[model samples]
Target: GNEYPEDLAALPPQIIIGAQYVQAAGVALGFKKKGAKNVAYTYTGDGGTSQGDFYEGINFAGAYQAPAIFVVQNNGYAISVPRAVQTAAPTLAQKGLAAGIPGIQVDGMDALAVYLVMSEARKYSVEGNGPVLIETLTYRFGPHTLSGDDPHRYRTADEEAEWEKKDPLVRLRTYLDEKGLWSEEQEEAYIEEVNEQINEAMKKTEQAPKQKVSEYLQNVFVETPPTLEEQIAKFAAKEEA
Candidate 1:
């Protein structure tokens, strides 16, 4: 079932957060209360660190020694706001220090490093050491979203170029090539295979039945927001017609 994505027995995601940043703390604590063996993780932006929920969640997780991982994607900018304006802290990872959680900073551009740190963080959480915080130092290669956000308003060309050099794909490919493990032929074949799979999935999606509003709510989260309650009722009525 869609509700049981992946191995439901291994990881049952009971809580789905809405727009409220406070939900992070509440959800993680809920999972801990249930005596879950797996770690619960939540992600927020650099700007989101200012949200009271971010602090509340970390504190709660630390207090109970909940298996929660707080992931902060410091993508340089929180939408239009720059990181410098967000906080004067030496590093975002250190924010967890106040909550009694250990912090690990990693090069967001280095995929291997990010994986290793996250792996260690998860192990720490499962070991009941409490939640660990990970601050991946990355850049927003594009606008915050597909919206009318333009990075040109704040960032300069040189800055973008600097990060561009640290592209995870390039670095990984370069390292693999140096070890005679990658080549242009291999890349082309892999790209072709991935594109074929993506296209097939898109075709399936397009041919699938038109989803009711209620189904949309079930897709990403189990909890429905108050605003969506009315919409869900209306969709149910329309679907019955």
Candidate 2:
């Protein structure tokens, strides 16, 4: 998550698909119990909407009227599978209707539109209302991952070029530039500043103390089991040598 210890809300990367939906619901309920105005927010792909946990999580939140925001990025493809084959739902946003929560769809490619919609969703959620489901209609430009999958096999060049025209960054940058709020010089300077910050972080990480296998084993349990204790001792001995 790269989140600071003091930060209460951070979306960590999880391997389990749609598991965080349940977690976000629980966190939102916790905030309500504490009488805090804070809301829990999480994102999932169109593919994750098919998971049982996704439905269960939204149902729970709706039942309790928990303040949560479920942002679904419908990028037209879930890995190599196209959206049509994934589910028969007319719109992913409508999936929340069964849970008795309001759902809204926004043009995800329009950065300003997304921002406005999210702002309204957050406001609705925090005002003693239940969770809101937001479906952002977007597109994936490349394969889900760099791992051997080829986009050319499933996606055509014409489709890729069409989505490229609607790229959010380019559209937003163009809008800002037209309004005299941005320029190529400013963008170049920002890029240079970000690179310098990255380099400084890398230097600090290089100077940090090396991690130990024994340290990991020792922290695994409050009272280490006999088998694990034996392994820890063996690793410790090797580290010392």
lDDT of all predictions: 0.76, 0.87
In model 2, what lDDT does residue 212 have?
73
lDDT of 2 by residue, 14-112 (tens): 578898899789878777787777778989999999899899889999999999999999998888888899899889999999999999999999999
For model 2, the superposed segments whose C-alpha errors exceed 4 Å read: 1-13, 196-241
> Lowest-lDDT window of 10 residues in candidate 1?
1-10
lDDT of 1 by residue, 1-241 (tens): 0122232233322322312334445555555666556676678778778666778788877887777788888888888888888788989889889998898888999998999999899888776677888999988889987979999998999999999999998999999999999999999999999999999999998997765666655444457777777788888888999
Q: Which whole-number lDDT from 0 to 100 does residue 66 have in model 2?
A: 96
Best by TM-score: 2
